[model samples]
Target: MIDDAGSTLTAELSAYHPLWHLKRINWLEGFGASVPEDEPITTRVFLIDTGVHVGHPYLSKAIDAQLAIDFSALPFGLRYVDGINKPIEFDPEILDHLPLSANDKATISQLMQRASGKLCKAPLETALHTAFPSHGTACAGLIGARMPGFFTDPLPSLTDGKPALAVPYWGVDPLSTIIPVSTSLNPTPGQLILALVYALQNQADVIHLPRGISVAWMSDNGEYDNPGLSLKTDQDEAEWEALEALLFAISRTVPIVCAAGNSGENSLAYPANLSLEDKGENGIISVGALSSAGFRSSYSNYGPGLTVVAPSDDATVFNRYQIRINELGRRYRLHDYAGYVGAGLPRVDFSREAILSTDIPGQNGYTGYSPLGYDEDDDTFAHANDPLQGAFTLFGGTSAASSIVAGVVALMTRRAKMKGQILSGPQLKQILRATARGTPADTKADDINGDKASLELLFGSGLVDAGKAVGKIGA
Candidate 1:
């Protein structure tokens, strides 16, 4: 956790690492502001995406499990109001279809029992089987995973007697609360609308949508046009209208931080694109990703709707490293290596540049401990015998960037409440835009369909300046 001295347990970690992304955005400077002690307000950030692994040690304290809602349990095409009235029931028979062990099924049943009602519960084993179990968990961790005070086993540090790794990890806003809302990987328009409604009812201070919907149809010139303008069917048009209405209502109060898709195109996905139409204060905050080298991330989508950019993995730097130690049997024991070197042990580098966050524990999640030996070329590393093997992994994309922005918003909200003032969604958005730093020097304007665009068109206002934004809250 961040203390008064502004130093964390993972402070001595490597300079060339994933955590550097936080420093790039001046996160610590922003966190230094004083919040009112007599009247504290809990900033609740509603994370609408694949359910989080609430049981993860790093995220256990940050998440509010009782308020978590799983819309995936509701049948498709179910109306938003009906889902609220209906109780979500997990069917045991569905587990039978999955190729899981009997023990896994039993554990899932236990989790289901605990998750009954509005309480959100995501079984680690079940999530591991999904396409991306770490998706929501990683995003949540980026927003508010608490820094553990103690470790079960000491981690391997590059320096002798100093406990540090390739990167130290923690949430951007550890004091904020996260409300995990579970949904299918590709949720329908109705399901997304339902999630937004749930967040609004819960009085969420900030809503982070790590995913995006492309409601706009592509034109013959290879550009995404306005939403609901080229819909082919009445049903599609109706769904778009419903989504717009809900967004319009929510934007008036709560800031909806959205990822500017990963399509690498010049167009933003729906809702994120809505930022373009949002001239008011309370509106969508579209976030794009910036590479480690201070440039717009190659995969991040950019256009007029982008509100700001944040530091994210550029897929160039390697964040994952494996080292062999002599103390094989001792748990979490790092050998006192001579100097900072690991006594000439064979080290492995596998993972690429990405944000580090909590993942599903054990071998089920990404960075699983594989027994078949290490494959340096593969993204997943074999931590079978490593003492530093914990519930953490490297993740990237505009989604990660969006989560970081949401965390900043949470901090700003807390700061506002501390000052005995309430900043509306639009006020916060305006502050962020006003305080944002200029775009990176490497960022260049792009020509979209023979039309020259300015840097603002590509990177929105500019990079998000957390310190400036937080300091300006209530001013």
Candidate 2:
């Protein structure tokens, strides 16, 4: 089915675009900034997203072939390629219809039902059908690539009025294995422990979790101080303790990166801030968001726990639009702003305005669904088409921020792999933080508490200089 044009979404999404401000940064004037093809570092990033679409042009280049191996051991029906997985037969509405045997699907479904709270889960079948246009897919696009062999032929022969599947020139195997978990997966205390164990069993180098205790444990009252929302409370303390224990255990193996959270509040999001307590270790990276203006977006939660900031598009206007409502209920559209993007916002800071990366081939259910129209309040409307800019639209949230940081971690790891340097997680975090550049003296400061501060909590480490980070590769 044809989808809405991205141009409209792009127009609406301009303000929220994370790199919106990067466009404003005078990279030419920067002391060390240069748009060079090669950097001191180029690493392999393992993107943990819903699934990536193999058909998009951008991802075709980043797929790492050397690591590709057949993982038919995973459900046999699933196919991989094109920097995305090929769609399979499954109904979007049916959450439990894997072609695997009844017992098998049941087992997987049950596992996901329990774990769904932490991982961003969706039907693998749905991801394939839509070509994965969800937040997870967009994340993968920001990292690695897809190989051409996955696409046997661009022009497959048509049969029964349907295009034939492309044939691969070489036998394709799984690259950077994916262990799918539900986006809604909320792990029980026991389950969280088990899953962490499983992830470690798989030797996952870095675990990217989108949600944590703070946002997950909030209450209906909507107060941050309430024990319900605070991680220190009785209901959440156990979970927090378990997560911390797991983090400590896992840090011994792989580093963990979490989104700082999208809540525009005074405190740092839990777990993200928790990791920042200086464990004297390298197992955690807490990332914040930076706007295109090279400043922190207004909405991102910020505080001391922040390790660094990345290109998490602070806002996607296409995702959320606010309409003004009067006392009489008369309503009119003001400006539709993307959460983090605006004039003077942080830009991608690269020569190419768009960060050239992977793209999902089809629609994941989130976008392209029939629009979620105005709510009872009439103050907002979420046009399904309006929620996305392209199959590869821009989005922001600690979710995007988390993945961006993970990608950088991957690249750093890869660079180290090449240089024969063996650095641990604590070491990496220190290097990244130490190399960070500060905000300029004349740069506009954040208006917090009726006064401006040179170093605001939101955009930590100033603007992330990937080039500088790369330059500091060996250091």
Candidate 3:
């Protein structure tokens, strides 16, 4: 249950995401079967969201700075532009998302042949709409935080050079390169289509869209409701129709992971709900947020289309490091709430609980910068006294969960490369469904909207099993 009293439950002196907080990282080693591979092929994950700060050491160290692009700028037609407004190095081998004429390929080849390394701007700066990397950077870090071997392989930890529990675990695959494309927080349907088109042409292995467009709807009382998803009436068919075609085209190329919104209802959000029917199954994978206690998050939306769940708040029974899934799994230890702790119904404290990640520099939310949000202190709730408050902050939503799954997708691809396995988009979804861990059976089904069948309303297939998904490639 969320505490309306506005009390702080968990705080600390540093800014980090402990492995305990992100229990999914531990699944890289096959959940209890095999250990992490010695060396895996590096893959690329395309982040389609708020722009990221490419200079951040944490993300920069793990990614190729050359692959970053910003789409929230002028000339939205061609593709996601660089900070200086130049075209990305087009290689036919990696880029097959868009069908290009032979002449087009020849022209690109000529440009690359005459390319100069110093094409960057004199004074580096991205457009206002695209420069802020707050949300996108955070998601990129979770997928591949530039730490030591710790990020690539999860295990025991030592905080500040001392043995400490709840060690801030980093990315699922630190070696994966990130292609940062700045799609706005609230982009028009036109802008959304362009971003999708770019992802396909650019050779993105796994694409993560952490935001959704909620169309207004009318309630039973004849009153228009707030911005929520209305399948039939929300945003005209013409608007979403063009984008859905692009979505179908892209889904066939790469796995697109989208968030299931944070509205705390049983509604379906667009883009997140964009699925291509193949073999009588939906191709889009929607991710919901999970609490640290291994239960469905109270603020997470639940309904018919959820594909899997991941952690958002790090204060539940699932986050405890030493605890294994044995006979002792019956009793769970919750961090903030001590009330009635049961199996899957782990209660979460929204205020004091969150996933720490990279924040926009000098924004109103973080100290060193001016206000970015309407209120300068919008992010103070997450980063109160951290020495590097301006660089890192905390956030908890389906956005974070979506990125977590995207990171695992990178790991899955890496495992596939080593084992000479080639699994398509549909195959990956089946592996996730077969291997995922089920959520608490106590929560009631989401029958809010009529005529919707649900295996588990709160969580679709179940909690994402990172290790099992990767292991399936070799099997």
Q: Please give the lDDT score for candidate 1.
A: 0.66
| TM-scores for every candidate against the unseen true structure | 0.72, 0.56, 0.67
For all predictions, the C-alpha RMSD in Å is: 12.9, 13.4, 11.1
Q: Which stretches of candidate 2 lie over 4 Å from their true place?
A: 1-124, 128-133, 146-192, 212-240, 278-282, 314-366, 369-390, 441-444, 448-456
Model 1, which residues run further than 4 Å from truth?
1-3, 7-16, 34-40, 73-125, 150-167, 216-236, 278-281, 315-352, 362-390, 439-453
Residue-wise lDDT of candidate 2 within 1-475, one digit each (tens)? 0023223323322433333422232211121221122443333343333334433443435543223222211332123334443322222223232123454334333443443222222233433564333554555554333334432433222222332322111101112223432221223343444444444544455566655443443446644432222334553444544445556656544667777777755567756776665664546777776654454554566777677776544332122222111222212234333333454443322111123222332333334423243332235443334322233443456665566566555555554555667766676676667756665631234543332444646566654545455456655
Ranking by lDDT: 1, 3, 2
Pick by TM-score: which candidate is best? 1
Better of 2 and 3 by lDDT: 3
RMSD, candidate 2, Å: 13.4
What's the best-to-worst order under TM-score? 1, 3, 2
